[model samples]
Target: MKRRVAITGVGLIDPLNESINNFFARTIRGESSIRYFASKGDPVPVSIPAVYCADFKGDDLLGKHRTISMDRFSQMGLVAAFDAWTNAGFNVHDRSHKPNAGVSWGTALGGTRIYEQGLREMWINGRERLPPLSVVMGMNNACSSHIAIQLGLGNSSLTYSVACSSASAAIGEAYKRIRNGEANIMVTGGSDTPLIYGVIRAWDGMRVLSPGNEENSPSACRPFDKSRSGLVLGEGAAALVLEDWDHAILRGARILAELAGYGANCDHVNLVKPDSSGQAAAISLALEDAGIPPKDVGYVNAHGTATIEGDPSEIEALRSVFGRQAKELAVSSTKSTHGHLMGASGAVEAVITVLCLKNSIVPPTANLKDIDTSCEGVRHIRIGDSNKSDLKAAISNSFAFGGSNAVLVFKST
Candidate 1:
């Protein structure tokens, strides 16, 4: 109960791969999933394209409501979780364990696709009329609930809806549960499908999204760069099998990485913009939790959304927390290649950080023509391709729309 937690298995379904192993292998080869193709027909201005999971048909992975009603985001979470559980070599209902298995899914906006669709049907059909599956499918917790039901995970099943940091927070909470003797295993992650027109329109209202970037599609996300304009939206889901370190070893499970510490802070200052001081505090708190010095951190997976306010604020946050070490740190944003997956951003990027440690490499920032003079001293890997090396420890930051900041520190297993 006093020790650490380890990632036993991880499954990802995004623009990169339908499976986790495939995604990591491809990433090591310096591949990207960003594309300019449009789903609605006509030449739509799409930038910061991401690796997106393809469509799913009726299947057991979709569970009981396979043919009925479900959103793309929830469906993807289920599929990814299915693979994650199998990869971890455990089943939710196995009599070998009790109360040890749990489910926690996070999302910024859950099942918006289902929500908008149901709303349209209701407006067209009237309250007297009905869409049979509206109630169960459109709810914000639907994704978590569905997976819980199919897996028989009982009351421990829950959802955290904290925008971009949602997934990392979910992972952090699960880590605590396992370490405190509450549970032995938990499946935690996030899902989102914001590529839909309705979803895009919601983000566009904030005026932080890119209109278009014709020349740099994959590299449209120029994090911490002077040429950085704004963030490009992307979507996907990722799930991790988190288990107690000893239990995973006893079960002969493969360890991906060790989750040493996690810290979450809220600005409570603004609804949209983050408080840089608050964000900096989160990282310092995480480092304290890990019992490690800031200089020991080898790399940082920055939030780096490339927004007008986000990049500089985070850079300053780093400077406040790590001081001179922040200047020499190898920081990069995967958002440049994958775009921001909203709810799933933190979870998926956490997986990326772990794998980068396991594989002894760092994925490139994708697009960095000119560095911002303000961020000059901070070491951001401005290369356009993957670079290989031994990574000892890494920090991942995810800041969301509601001024929620989540930071996690991972060490080699």
Candidate 2:
């Protein structure tokens, strides 16, 4: 028998370090956290616009002993996971074995910062060896393993590293686990710390890193606009607690939203460029999985990286799927405000989408001035616009570099 999955809790580490309520409120207000980042006194200095959680002190949150051997990405993921567990009404102090719960996480460049530091120590500082815990901390599965260990989840501990689609794919798989009765609860999300020197240099080489001065850095990520540039890299994490509907009901958990459907597929046409046909197929499959029609999906949290090719391609996919209904569909890209969180983007955007359904208010695409003609099929939610639409369902889109696409359909419970 197929069971239903419900989202009982959500958590994240963003630039504000604020509560989830404040984060959602600020996002709806179209506020941007991006700032100018310039590396000084380095062998190769790079300047760009990015979002960093300057106030996040993992040691303070997770304590020194617990975070002693974890990498920055692992620390961020564990913090978010613990917050989600507590928010879901689970006792963090009760670390008893739970054979019915598990963890699924994702990251594109897990522990890249740690590896970079080790390389610098060996090549530049003449160090003979890295820290003893470097291998354990730098593993991509470290975060998920830590979560399972701390919570005593014994069903499964899995990790996915599919670039930008990592988190969405993780969340989707967790939903499937609960839907298929494989587990009663699952902690799922993704995190990435991509603001490192080498990471930025590589993205800069690709010419996809948007440029900005100190004054305009906040508006550097302008998606679907005539003057839109490219993506701004950000560092953060987001997590969700998925539970079986009956289990949540038995426990009297406050259900946030229903994770109704998930569809994932490979474009297979290009390594970096997006194909609209593949994207449309994924969207159609997700809607079909949810037993929902195109006209019923009220809003879309677009994976709008503001690149020249990505924005129009996403809009074209929507046009092909929804046809005339696309004209009235509300669409916005929260990346305009939060910047892109790389592998973690999908999880953070999914949280925002769930909030939209709960509050019946859609957030506008921050800094969107004029929509490009190719991206004008839908009702573009722009800054300063009233967004209090009564929405029943919404979808979050995540398209990654290796032609991986994942779409999540969520409905108000």
Candidate 3:
């Protein structure tokens, strides 16, 4: 028999707030974290509205010496992983390696900020002027490597870069390893700091970013709404501590929820566009993995990026999976408030999904004033909170740019 997995702890370094309680409270209030900013030191000047982690101080989480050599993305991941470790009642500085513990992290644009700065220094100045640790700081696996080193996890350390589904894939892969008896515990999630000048300029060229008006910048990301324009890029990291159910019970750890199932697939059709059939297949596969049917899931955390095509495609996928019951399923996209965190979105949303199961309350999809006709049937959680005493299970969906999709099923513990 497969071992059961329990999500014992979770952590976040998001734009809304660092503390989980504070973040959930702000989410319940439907507050938007999107803001506008002007570019600095670029060949061409640009202005755009995006979600940024303005309050995160790396030195505060990691000492000044440790953070000096770490990139912003790696720093965020380390902070979040440390938070999860502490929250799980483990000492952050305990370097005593656990034989069965490992790490799996994901990132799409890893260390972009440091890479951009390195290029700028090389171009504007001389080759010798570049930072000495530039290569180490800009590597894609730097975050996961740093996390494993800090936590003394020696079993395995892996990284995934499946665009938007990166984090979800990491967590899902970790879940499988534990269930298959390869490890007893895993530190898993994703992180990305893509708000750098070059990264934002690339996204700007794609024309998928929200064009916010100066008067109402906070309301720019309106997922599933009729006036929804596009996604707002955000930066952050989220981490979770997944343990074997028996191991958690043996240690008397507090169980937040059970990771009952995970499903991942590729659209194989378009790079930027979503395929409804592919999404539906992933959802069905997750349900099958969990040994549950469609009617058993009470809530869905959507991959609603608020783009014109993205929202409708997700709605169609839900319709295909839930059939007539789609009209009654409580669905919401927290991106409506926190903006899209890119690679870290799935991990953050998974934390939110587990919280929803534990608290029995569904967070509102902020800024959804008018639901589009194409997204009408599904019951979109709007402006106010909805409490369901019988809420038993929830699914968090993540669809990425490479046509990759990942869905995670969480159940009340």
Candidate 4:
């Protein structure tokens, strides 16, 4: 028999350092953390419109000794994971082993900051070597390994690096593990820090980074708007604790929502361009997996990155899947306020979706005033709009550059 998966806890490390509650409140209120960010202590600094946690002092939070061996990405991941674990009522001080519990994390550019720093030290400062434990800290799996070790999760420690879909894919797989009865609990989510010089230069070359002056930076990411430019890279982490329904009930845990379905598919059409058919297929698969009719889904946390093509493609896909009901389905992209967290976007958005269901409030796409003609059909939730409908289910989408599409379905418990 297939076991049911429940979301017992959720946490996030956003640019504003807001707790999960504050984040949701501000998000639905259309507040933005995006700003004009400039790199420091580098010969060729990068200045871009982005969302960054300027107050995140790793050493102060994680302790200087514990953080000495970790990269910024791993530090954020561990903090987010630990927050989720504790929120789930798990004892962080308990070092006891749990064979049925595990961790599945995701990151696209894990430890890139460390590598960039090392290269800078070698080339500019004439240093022959990097810091100690650089290799262990720079590995993509380092975050997952650290979470498992710190939490004493022994069932499995896995990581996925599928660009934007990384987190959703990781969450989906963890849900599958619990649903398949292979595990009783799983701590799953994703983290990414893409503000390094190299990463920025690469994206700048692609001409996909949003442009904004100091006055306009906060509204840079206007998804589904006619004046939309491009995506703004953000750095942070988010985590969710997925537990077996029976196990959570036995422990008297507070279940937040049900991770009902996960659908992942590849477009195979283009590397950068999105295909509506493939996206629709994935959404259809997720609804089928959850045994939920399209009409039952009241809201969608769209993967609307405000790109020239991505925004419209996602709307078309939703219309194809939901048909006439798509016209009434409330849809929004929280990326407008949080910016794009890249690999961690899915987890962050998933956490927001869970909160939306819990509070019965659907957040709007911030800074979206004029809707683009090509992105019509759905009930677009604009900034400051109050949506207190009895939302039964919601979908969060994560479509990546490599044609990877991951859709997660959640329902009120």
Q: Score every model by TM-score.
A: 0.91, 0.99, 0.97, 0.98
Instruction: For candidate 1, write residues 1-413 as lDDT tens digits.
Output: 37789998887775744566677665554455666635453135433354455554425556554636666777888877877887778774564453567888888888777766666567655755556676666677787876776676653787898988999988888888887878888888988888776667667777787655445566667887888878888778889888889999987989989999989989888988878998998998888888889988888899988887888888889889888777778888888877888989888888999888888887767676687876665777756543666777999998877788889999997
The TM-score that candidate 1 achieves is 0.91
Worst 10 residues of 4 by lDDT: 89-98
* Model 3 score (lDDT): 0.89
Candidate 4: deviation at residue 307, Å? Answer: 0.2
List, residue by residue over 1-413, the lDDT tens digit for candidate 2: 78989999999997978898999999999999899988765798888999989899989999999899899999999999999999899987775538899999989999998999999999999999999999989999999999999888999999999999999999999999999999999999999999899999999999998889999999999999999989999999999999999999998999999999999999999999999999999999899988899988999999999999999999999999999999999999999988899889999999999999999999999999889998998999997887998888899999999999999999998
RMSD of each: 2.8, 0.9, 1.3, 1.0
Q: What's the ranking of the predictions by TM-score, best on top?
A: 2, 4, 3, 1
Please give the distance, in angstroms, between residue 408's alpha carbon in candidate 4 and its true position after superposition: 0.3
Per residue, candidate 4 scores C-alpha lDDT tens digits across 1-413 of 78889999988896887677888899989899999999888678888899999988889878988788889999999999989999999887786647999999989999988888888889998999777899988999999998998899999999999999999999999999999999999999999999988899899999999998889899999999999999999999999999999999999999999999999999999999899999999999999999999989999999999999999999999999999999999999999999999899999999999998998999999999999999999999996676887889999999999999999999998
* lDDT, candidates in the order shown: 0.78, 0.93, 0.89, 0.93
Q: For candidate 2, list the clashing residue pairs, or say none.
A: none
